[model samples]
Target: MSARWAADLALGVRLALGGGGARTAWARLALTATGVGLGVVVLLSASSLPHMLAARADRSAARLPVAEAAGGVDPVFAAGRDDEFRGRGLQGYLVQPTGPHPPAAPGVDRLPGPGEAVLSPALAALLQSPEGALLRPRFSQRVIGTIGDTGLTGPNELYFYVGAADVAGQPMAQPVRGFGGEPARRGLDPLEVLLVVLGATTCLVPVFVFVVASTRLAAAARDRRLAAVRLVGADRAQVRRIAAGEALLGAFAGLVAGAGLFLLVRVLVPRITVSAFRGGIFAADVVPDWRLGGPVLLALPVLACAAAVFALRKVVIEPLGVVRRGTRVRRKLWWRLLPLAAGGALVIGRLGTEDARDPFVIAGVVLILVAVPVVLPWLVERVAGLLGGGSPAWLLAVRRLQLDSATAARLVSGIAVVLAGSIALQGVYARAEGDRPPPGNVRVLATAFATGVDGARAFTTALHALPGLAGVPVTTHALLQNAAGEKFSLAVQTCAELAVAGCRDGDVYTSDRLAPGAGLWSGGADRTRPPQWTIPVAGHHVTAQEGAALIVTPGALSTAPGLALSVNATIPAAGPDVVEQVRNLIGWHGRVSSLGTERDDTSALITRVLSVGSVLVLLFAAGSLLIAAWEQLRERRSTLAALMANGVGRGVLARSLQWQLAIPVAVAAVVAVLAGLGLDWLLLTLLVHRPMVADPVAIGILTATAAAAVLLVTAVTLPALWRTASLAHLREE
Candidate 1:
């Protein structure tokens, strides 16, 4: 029996291959392979993730400095300084050797001395670029070397090591003897795991749908061919095996094509500079795990074969003609809806405090997502039945779809699932990011340096000198109080700094409330008096601005004995990079923030990814849809030709083709959007316990994107429609 099956399968492959000059047969095979290949690539990419993550983790672990090892060979004072430039994060280590033979940094040749630095390739390039002018001053140390790949997980990682004279007292600094340690073993929190699972699962589902659809592309033609084979005395079981054999060839070819495609994408991964990915991945790390890959490679062909065989169950190939069983068989609504209802109920849970990790919840979500395509055929059939009253193109399209709405629905299902998933994810993502706080017009930075008055003056001068801060007025004031146990407080600023105070540059202005010859504490108003200066000549008294504290220009304190003033620099409307530059100048322990403005890097990254990723993934669905349309065109070439023979213009046939695909696509998009919104609302309100704040912008983008994808598919299939409409095909039909 096995030998007989093999013979029948071999015959089927040859028939599918069309060893003779069979143009239509070869086209169908190629289309099937291309569709399946695209899906295989996605599956391979999903499987590669584990290896990619593990490789990255291993590299990250290897580069971590071991803090305070027992019997260390050599120790160095190390501190972590995480900084950002133009939204790209850079990891830096401040190193100070504590021993004669200090260990070198992870990728550097040796430990850096004071005034020297080692930079990553990416950072080195950025520092040399014209765009890095604002960031250049932040790393004032001379570049001695570049970090090697061994120390970096990603090619685009911004990382470096800079020499520090002393890191002993700096925040987060510690003594480290070597670099090598296991990465943190902490797993993701419950909510995070749920998000990850949902994201990954939702992403892969459409690919699988596409693959299943691909297996049965041009099924009508294949079934007719199988009927001809039956005329040549092929048994029913042999016919099934023969069909499976055809699918096996396409699936095998697709597997090879997918591997090549996967490799091509892997090569391009390093070039992706998305901030959310934290620098792009290394091509070498983007390997598919054997355990996952072996199964995937094997399963695709098997699934393809199975799908082909299963599709044949809907049609019986007799010696006379193929008879499609499902045409007259009404699709039962009860069973189709049972899965959706059960999935929704399980997924939604009991609204209150159910854990995200609940097995039923996750399974329920999966079932609901999977059920979209399941109920889609029925939905499309109903939609098609209701669709009426239009041009000949529309009427023809409606009639054709009403004949085999299931096939049309299955093809549209790929994008529908993706669209729905993307919308739900976007809603959750938007809520997760939260609403950004309204930014203050003025840039408020409170930076305190341990450096005395001379350092303070130099810092103030430096802030004025920054090119980015050109034309920006900077106002700084320091509190100067009396030491003679006087009750009044004083603030010092130049006339240009504050127009309200109106103190001239060299004016020694004092408020009318100031006591005569009050002794001032030069070191500020502290209990322990370091030194005192007498208000020698209290000449002019001006109106106090608002309260007891009064303004004095910096020139007023120039000649004061033992002068020390803590300054607060508030540069109104400072540029974005100016804050980071200020942060660099202030270094560790300094506080810098814009009042009322919040910056969440993770949230920002997620927003960026969602906007870009949805568009990218939609492209995959578009490819599948395009192949489906082409296959349908090839299968119905005779029909198109017959229409043309009946005096129907090519333009009308073209519009008919468009209508056929568009109606189902439009319905699918609407269903997807509505389903996504509903799912997002349920998840947010019940599971996540957050308000459903639907992002209209994201929704609009997703809708427009899906529409664009459909248009693209429709446009690409036009040539096929034109070719299929040739009157010669009528004779063939």
Candidate 2:
């Protein structure tokens, strides 16, 4: 606010904008701005995700049939006949109106009439494809119309509504007055909450680390510049204000750039994710959560200013000059480990409960993950000091690291955090994917209720007509009770139908001779009634059925007049497509599923979220490392140039650069892997209470990513190294 402070701030801003003797200032500023910008894009997108998913959920819930509404003045009978073709699942329903003027479902102008079907655009396309040959039998009804976007959660949904004379085929059919129901919202269970928390933390923490690192770029050069200002009679406070201004300039630019990038992503993402590869959302859904977005807007500049000013705290910038401290004192280790230790204590204290989602446990997990970066500096410093090699390139890198390893640590701290967090999250995801019920032996089944002998016969004939079961061995079964109240299940077929079980036409079977007056009931166990006929009094039983209970021929049960029974037809092969084809046969009366679809969807969701975050994290980390490499070059310009002038080959300098970053990052990667698995194991043993399952694939992927980042930094900086080491630039400061 004061004139002096204002003057000093303006001076620092000009210096950062490259007005002073700093030749590499423009590159440094770009690195900071770019770092902040990338972080902003990810943060903004993460904030918008909840709102986007909620919108998708609302659309999905809008079309659900509400059976409770069936009793309203106007009603329609509805049954779900959802099916799958190939590996792609589809939504479908069979409906018939009980009254005139029945309400239409969402996305359709009119309710379908008997013998017609309304299809979604994607389904219509599929039906026209050559692959539809296998699916055409299931939707034999005439195509009268198509469902619109209003009825679908995403553009590529396969959905249909077929008109039927009656909804008797489905077990869940009931009259529904109309279709809208409340959104099917469910709160995240504890494991889900844990995942969300970890997901958010992993994404944002690295950004903050990046911001802090970016603001402190070219620390040695900044210190020297401040010393010159001190020599010119500017006091400590004014010098500090100048540094803060320079940092703020980059942060401000980043904030603006980030806002622009976020908007661009909103427009581009929907267009790119247009199909089933990943579900696409409407542009309207990409609105940020102010709760998270607001802080990112407010904090970046503060972090920049604070990191710049704080780095100056230990350096005494006197009028004469200051010796830029690299390793005057040994790095401390105990305090660095304190957060991890304390957080672990808190988690262990709360073990065996809601610890997965418990705030204390979450806090502990954060500390442990964050500790990867904190402990990294100490680890790198110690390891770099002990490292030795005969190779000239390796010697050059190690000697320099032995002088100032903290720089090496900062170079990959963001990388370590991102990788460690990713591994822990992946472990939990693998566990969730595996925790499913086993599949059953029956691949396809069809069932329906029948009211009379005639109804039973019709249902039986319909079972025989079920599409996709041609030439497949089929058995029709029913559960029945006797007049004496004993219950048993029966499988009946013509002897021709029993050929699969080694029976011929004219084969006959009999049951144990019952007490006088005891006979089979026409109804099932759920509906016991009087005998349809008395037990036979004959002393002889038929031998053509081998005296078995198998109803190899219908004549076995025909003697009991009026044998009405419900029906179920089973084909018994649990191979691929068997369930879908069989389930289509039974239609709405029963469900055919392996329950694996939901698990696949969940896995896809995890992949989509984490895969994007991992990429962003990689880009952020790699870019930051590249900047650090450039900063090192600028700081050592005098040394590197003099070495080149003395005939040190460019190859040696390049290999040294590689060794400098790779050494520390390699050590950090191992530390990261241990810390990540340790965190994952703790969560699993205590919170998830599942077996400890480590994902080697996750570990390998993240480790390779970190290595790639290190390699990228070295490769990109080598070109800059040659430029910095030119003969014309060889001058001692």
Candidate 3:
């Protein structure tokens, strides 16, 4: 506020704007600005993802309002079925409304009448193909129109609206309401929550690393400059102001660049469509709201300035010079391990607990992630101390790390976190997939509802003729009264085929009679012997006691007149193509209501998201490492040049740079691997009782990737190091 203070602040501002600096100093400042700018760009882009997805979802929902608005309304006519077409699944609905139709949507000009269907573009394309002939007969309707986008179908899914008569059977039950005209806004479900968390983790972790690395760029040069000001009698407060000013300069520039980048990216994002979503996000949605974006843009400079001032805390600035004040107290090794221990304990305690919330699990994961950076510096220091004297390059590298192990560790911290995540996810994915049978090998169950015995028999015969079907078991339903006069529905399968076709249990003919006092009768010794005729109950007796007992008997079809027949067939290869074929053939005789395959689509989706997250993390880590390495080389230019002038070979200098980068990364990688394994073990115990299978190939690849990233970064700095060690650099120093 005083005149002198005002002058000092102005001087600091000028200095930040390159009032007195070498060309290289300005270049380093530019690099720092660029890094910060890109970090902000990435942050904004990631933040906009949720909005973009929502916009697309809204667009889809708007097109299917009739389906959306059907809640609580009884349908005049309705029929729906799920079947596979070619290699894709298809969901078809047939409706004839007695009341007013829904308002026209974006995709459909008008509703289809009898014998006509409106299909999604994807379905329309399929029907126009040669293979569409196989699928056309089932619908038995001409395609009248195409839907552009609708919530009733996924980007990759097939959906159609047809006349009521197009479906094979009369409505079995009232049609479930579709999403009404209003877009159904819902909070994130469990799976979606996991996706958002992982997505944020992947995007933000890199930004954090970039921010830290950028603030540290040319730190030594900045330190020396600040030390000169202290030597000239500037107080600590003044020194802090100068450093803050310098940081703010770069941060503000970065903020402007970031905003520009966001706009530029928004221009291109609308053109890019993700197959996972089956569409591109609207460009307007990708724009960040200024109410939120404004604060974020302003906060970066503030944080950068704070980081700069914080870095100066350990220095003792005297009128004579500045030196780092050594501390008598050392950070205890055990203190670094506390977070890891606490996190591991939390995970172990919570595993398989009934009331465990997802937030609790995510918190545990956070603690584990935090512990890596916390403990890494200490580990690096200890490992560097253990390495004995060797080549000059090795000694120089080891000594440098021992002097400031934290900085060395910080350089590779991003990769350490990424590696940890990738390894843990790999273990979880492997264990999840291992517990299930391979897709091609698992069996599929298809159930058909037929009107009578003849139709069921025909369906069974057709199922037997299908290429992949193993067996067709047909059963007849009838109401049978027990001696107690309690009636239950009985499903009768042939006694001769019971051994191989129906329930393989030898007690198939045994009576499970319900008693008045006791809950249910286990077969009595007297009833164990095969009788002239036996009834086998198949479902829950308590529920069955309310109705007729479901009995499986050989003579039910012959004796029980007018009974409905159902046939179930097992197919060995339950691929979409095979399932579609089976559905088509069975449709000729009966309504095929339910078809289920062994494949876990949820697991597949999780795997895909994990893969994308892993790739993003790798890119972020690699970028941070590259920036940090270049900065380090620039900071050590004087020392490297002096060493070269004294006859230290360039090769030794190059090797020293590699060693400095490698030792800390290797330590971090080992810790990461252990942390990853521990996390995976805890997750598996919570989710399933599966063996911990370490995928060696995945582990090896992750380890190799870490090493490759370090190597590549080190290589990038070698040419710069070579120039820094030249005579010109020495003279300038």
The candidate that achieves the highest lDDT relative to the unseen native structure: 1
Better of 1 and 3 by lDDT: 1
- Which is better, 1 or 2, measured by TM-score? 1
What is residue 604's positional error in candidate 1, in angstroms? Answer: 6.3
Q: For model 2, how does the per-residue alpha-carbon lDDT over 644-691 read when each residue is reduced to its tens digit?
A: 988899999899888888888898899888887888877777766777
Candidate 1: regions farther than 4 A off: 19-23, 69-72, 166-171, 181-191, 292-297, 325-329, 349-353, 435-450, 464-613, 731-733
Under the 3 Å rule for N, CA and C atoms, how many clashes does model 3 have?
A: 17
Q: What tens-digit string does per-residue lDDT give for candidate 1 at 474-584?
A: 343344455545544556555665574544564555566564466666332343755344553643456646543556666555556344444456657656766777766
Residue-wise lDDT of candidate 3 within 617-640, one digit each (tens)?
A: 687678777877777777777788
Q: Estimate each model's TM-score.
A: 0.82, 0.79, 0.70
CA error at residue 238 for candidate 3, angstroms = 1.7
**RMSD (Cα, Å) of candidate 1?**
6.5
Worst 10 residues of 3 by lDDT: 517-526
Show the colliding residue pairs in model 1: none
